[model samples]
Target: MKFLRPALLGLLSLAYPPLVYLGLGHFEPRWMALPLAGMAVVRAVATRERVWLAAAVGALALAASSMLGNHALPLKLYPVLVNTVLLAVFATSLAYPPSVIERLARLREPELPASGVTYTRRVTQVWCGFFVLNGGIALFTAIGASDETWALYNGLISYVLMGVLFAVEWVVRQQVRARHVHG
Candidate 1:
């Protein structure tokens, strides 16, 4: 339980860019939008007031991918199909993460507990983690990937921001825990 929120936070954080990358970078053969859409759906099902918001976000992400795929040139069917597959994956992942998240949610869950803001914050960390990992891979992969400025920039910004936030939270948590123990 204690380790749950931190871990879930990492997972949720992963949602942001994979969604953004699919729409903006035009980089993947297989739409990597699954995780983002999954997170949105998970949020919807898990919460009462925000289900619509989550579902809408999930739909909009898929829509954006569809639009991007169909927007110009030869109107490729690949992107559209990819979007469908990604949506399916999102659905699958969303169904399962809850069991894991709920277990983690059960831990301490102080005053604010694991609400929307907490989830979002954690997801941001996961998002940043993805950027760091992907960016590092890209940075070292070869000349072409390494040379791409947009890849480096996008990855770096998310990674740095998330890293800073995580560090700050960790430090604060440590201080509070120390005070609780000492006082």
Candidate 2:
């Protein structure tokens, strides 16, 4: 029960690009942003986590700008905002110690070795780089691409890319584990 709201929110976020594409066809950008802003607020209230709060704040800012300017650019920048917030969280983890990946790794293996710590830090850095690149592309699409193109990339292509990255990382992690076991 506790996880249901957040799970639903995650699904909504995953559907955002397609929803925005459809909503823009039937409504004003300001009208579109209102629901998103409301959702962000709800998510923040539900999570009470700093990361969610930051995301909600960014969502509000985007919604405000969209409503005030009566433009769709802000509506389209949600992906960029998401990427930026994720980048900040991951990068901050790197600086603060126990990089994001290390923290997750520790969940299963509480006593992670020094080598595992180094590996997870490197993985976190890779993810930070991915966010920078992904966010840049999202920003570019929002600014210059057609609505269909933006929706296609943000809604579909970006997710495919993310899956590919995750799969590749998993493969690498498995190989690393094998090497550690046999070396």
Candidate 3:
């Protein structure tokens, strides 16, 4: 069930550009944003976490903007808005002890070594940079590029980049852990 939401979301994102271009045109913005926003709200209500609440608020704001008839703005900015929120989360975690990645690492292995802490912090910083770059590119695409271009980046390229980053990091992390365990 948890995986279902993101799978559906991925499907919607993949379909959005063509739907807008060939089917919906520029009039019905609510159809593009409301369902995602509604899901965000539901997730927020279920989790009751501040982060989820923030996402819900962002989605609701997008939905509201769509209702006001600024067609291009809502659909175009959704990815940018979501990335900005993610950027905030990753960047802010660096401001205090135990960055978000470190906390997750701790969950997996409670007795995190000193080197592990440093590594997680560095990984957190890398994620912060990724979010910044991702959000900037997304914003630029939304503003200057066509809808097809925007959807291509947001729906496909962005996810590919993120998956590559995650895969590389996982491989590196395992190697580091193995070395630590051996020596």
TM-score attained by model 1: 0.33
In candidate 2, position 136 carries an lDDT of: 95
Give per-residue CA lDDT, model 2, range 63-143, as digits (tens). Answer: 999999889999899999999999999999998998999999999999998889999999999999999999999999999
Tens-digit per-residue lDDT, 118-172, candidate 1 = 4534544453444445445433332233323433443355356658866876676
Which candidate ranks first by TM-score, i.e. highest? 2
TM-score, structure 2 vs. true: 0.96
Clashing pairs in 3: none
Q: After best superposition, candidate 3 residue 27: deviation in angstroms?
A: 5.7
Arrange candidates, best lDDT first: 2, 3, 1
User: What TM-score, computed on C-alpha atoms, does each candidate reach?
Assistant: 0.33, 0.96, 0.83
Q: By the TM-score metric, which is better: model 2 or model 3?
A: 2
Which residue pairs does candidate 2 place in steric collision?
none
Model 3 TM-score, 2 decimals: 0.83
What is the C-alpha lDDT profile of model 3 across 112-155, one tens digit per residue?
99999999999999998998899898898888988778878887
**Model 1 residue-pair collision total:** 6
lDDT of 2: 0.93
